[model samples]
Target: METILEVLKKMEKATAREMAARMKIDAPDALAMLRDHEDRGEVNQVNGYWQLTGRASKKPANAVPKKTKPPASKINEAVLVKLLHEHGAMTSEQLAKLADTTVRTVASTLAMPVNKGRIVREKRGNVFHFNVVSKTALGASKLPESASKPAIPVTETPKTASIPEKTETPAPQSSTAFVDTIPQLVSTNGQPAALTPKIIAGEIRKTKSRLVQLEKLRVTVRTQTRLQRSLGL
Candidate 1:
């Protein structure tokens, strides 16, 4: 916390991103520390930048006191959710960098979201790459592979008034194997719920399109850390 306050004193305003970079910690960690200070009347986020308050204030600067780092226990779901939204997919090891926590911590924390369907974990090679749950998948999930024609949604204008208006569900595929793109889902009754139409036809589809640049970020951070060590920061 003292380290954070000192950094804040040097800068006019600092966003979570800037603070994280300067502190050589994860962005979520910096944000969490700032918020903790804010709750204690020591700091506040102003114009998207964290600013010091009270004893931690800029005027009549206080000495940067030595303090032990706090144990990381709290899991910031909002930060995790935001990261998944931006990157589309990431492993817990990669995600730990953004959260400024250990990979083990993230692995434990991700269980709830994965179980709840808020995050989908797909096994790529060995480690699971966590992706955001597609909120718009509802429309596409109802159709099976055997469906001959894509049903025109009720929202669209019909070509002719004489034509009968009806919504047709696709026949369920016999294969139970999960697809590479979207995994097949089953309901509580152990019945396969088709997903083809639910994923594609839905007006509100939210799937991860791009992979998170975790490796690049890790490389850059390592370089920065080495530089900081050399400078005795």
Candidate 2:
């Protein structure tokens, strides 16, 4: 069965009832189908009517008509930005009038580019001017003029210190030789010490376990925190 959207596409622009009659479906069903298609981003609303978005259907010979592009007077943000770059600076109102768009859009567009450092803002009295800061200007080195000041002279001072002779400290004598006559103590515990391969393998295993545990714990903690905040806990 042909969908309402297909029928609407063929008709170019149609209301719920018109689409329903063309598709042989009830008006409510047609409306529901149209809504679903719209929600899926397959179609769009023009004025108060629904129509298939983008290019018109070429399959149907009797397709109503293709949608005409909006006039050049309707200036978009990109075009406005380009214009601003071409021209020096313009107020939001002036840009809106020039772009044939709302003042809000002009303000928003200006904000994004300014924040990105692609353009710079300057204030003149009460008005603001946006200018594109050239890369050369930003990175250019500032060298002092030779005519400004002469370089200071470097001075060397003579050392007046005296030398000292080195002496070797004597090693400690065996004063504790009397204590060496006492018997030496020994441990009797038989616990097995960790071997080299076993120690290395154990360390690697522990590291892997810690990483996995940390990742899982991080996710769980985030989820729990979100849940707690949502529940006002």
Candidate 3:
């Protein structure tokens, strides 16, 4: 009987007489039912003890199975942009090394829409380098030409040079005074004058000496003013 079989399963291994005693059934009937189960391979007999077979002991076929979850992506746009900003421009291999992932992963993440304007790629030498696009550069690239530089309208005509009124020219000064005013001996267009380091140094020294003289003159003038004020002159 099913009651006798349930008792046998709970006991793990039991003699047919023991199962009958637990189920309160006749020993003969319990032995006959156990013998039928053994023939059907649902139970097995080792020596005089009977036990449920492996197939009969398994969980029911209708039980729910655990579902397998999908793996998550390891890299994203923010992570790649952060790395580019911290390290400046870098190749795919360099980024991969710093991110602790594969080059393909870095490439795929950078190709997404979220990173479109934030990251830019340039080819230098034989390798492609990745850079984080600065806010200023991105905005400049998006600006219209007229917005960046004011455009002159074609309808507006530029003013022409005006004729000067007749006037008397000023008298010429001495060539010596004009020559002294020249800051340095610079090479003019198509002139053979050579501008050497020695010449530059000499000009610098002359200018410094002139500045010191001017400073001394300023101090002397201040002292003279103070003295005159104190003497009521």
Candidate 4:
């Protein structure tokens, strides 16, 4: 409280923000302090500014007044966007009047959204027209001209061929035209003209035994001749 009072005593007039800045306090705290002082008759409001009471005023208590800054106005961007979007477009001069803010503040606020692609602007001489970009038209604008036409899709039905009736196959041909062997696979006469493998094997064993007997006989004749010559017979 003393910090605010001392600041107020120095300046002819001060806003909440200015008082807060000098006193190292929040604006709301400064405002509350000022209101408390005003209630206690320590300070008074002069055109929305905080000033010391006439008794503490450095100027003559009846010295009328001098020009001072008006209360600071805040820019309402949401209202700005709505107003521009609904009203088609408007200049900063016109927007400031509608938003009850400074033209400079409105101009700067509108420019920020434009650089972000959220708004659009058009210029004419010294003034520029601003409007918030609407999302409803975005999709339609991005589509190609050819896409706008309704597509007529053609669906082709698959061709189904007629199924052939089932038919009986002829009996297999025994023509024997492709036969390679006759003696081994077919009968030449009604009699069994084939030789059994067992009979052939038996004949081969007999021939081998007869050859072994002849070899023994030859060995015995050589032994007898050698013995008779030794006995001189």
Task: Judging by lDDT, tell me the better candidate of 3 and 4.
Answer: 3
Judge candidate 2 at residue 29 and give its lDDT: 50
Go through the candidates in order and give each one's C-alpha lDDT: 0.66, 0.62, 0.69, 0.68
Candidate 4 stretches with Cα past 4 Å from truth are 1-72, 122-127, 138-170, 175-233
Please give, for residues 1-233, the per-residue lDDT of candidate 3 as tens digits: 24545777689998988887776655765676576555445677777778888624465889785353332236677887888889999997898888876665565455532234567778899998989878899899999987999877778655444445478897787854543445456345533346578986887899899999999997898779766766799
Task: Give the per-residue Cα lDDT of candidate 2 at 13.
Answer: 91
Q: If scored against the real structure, what TM-score would every candidate get?
A: 0.31, 0.29, 0.34, 0.33
Q: How do the residues 1-233 of candidate 4 rate in per-residue lDDT, one tens digit apiece? A: 24567777787688988977876655654675576556556688767787878744377878887554464366556888988866778887898888886665575455446656677878978887888777876677778988988898999975444345578997665635323223343456633334567854765687699899998997898679766766799
Ranked by lDDT, the better of candidates 1 and 4 is 4
Cα error, residue 186 of model 2, in Å, equals 70
lDDT of 3 at 194: 60
The digit string of per-residue lDDT tens for model 1 on 1-233 reads: 23677888888577978977876666765665666555446677766777776433354447575454465655666788888899879998789888887665576456546656777889999878998877677445666755847777789654323334487997666456443224335655566665676665441333322223665676788779766766799
Order the candidate numbers by TM-score, best to worst.
Answer: 3, 4, 1, 2
Off by over 4 Å in 3: 1-73, 113-115, 153-233
Worst 10 residues of 4 by lDDT: 177-186
RMSD to the hidden true structure, all candidates: 37.9, 23.7, 30.0, 28.8
Model 2 Cα RMSD, Å?
A: 23.7
Q: Candidate 3 clash total?
A: 0
Can you list the residue pairs that collide in candidate 2? none
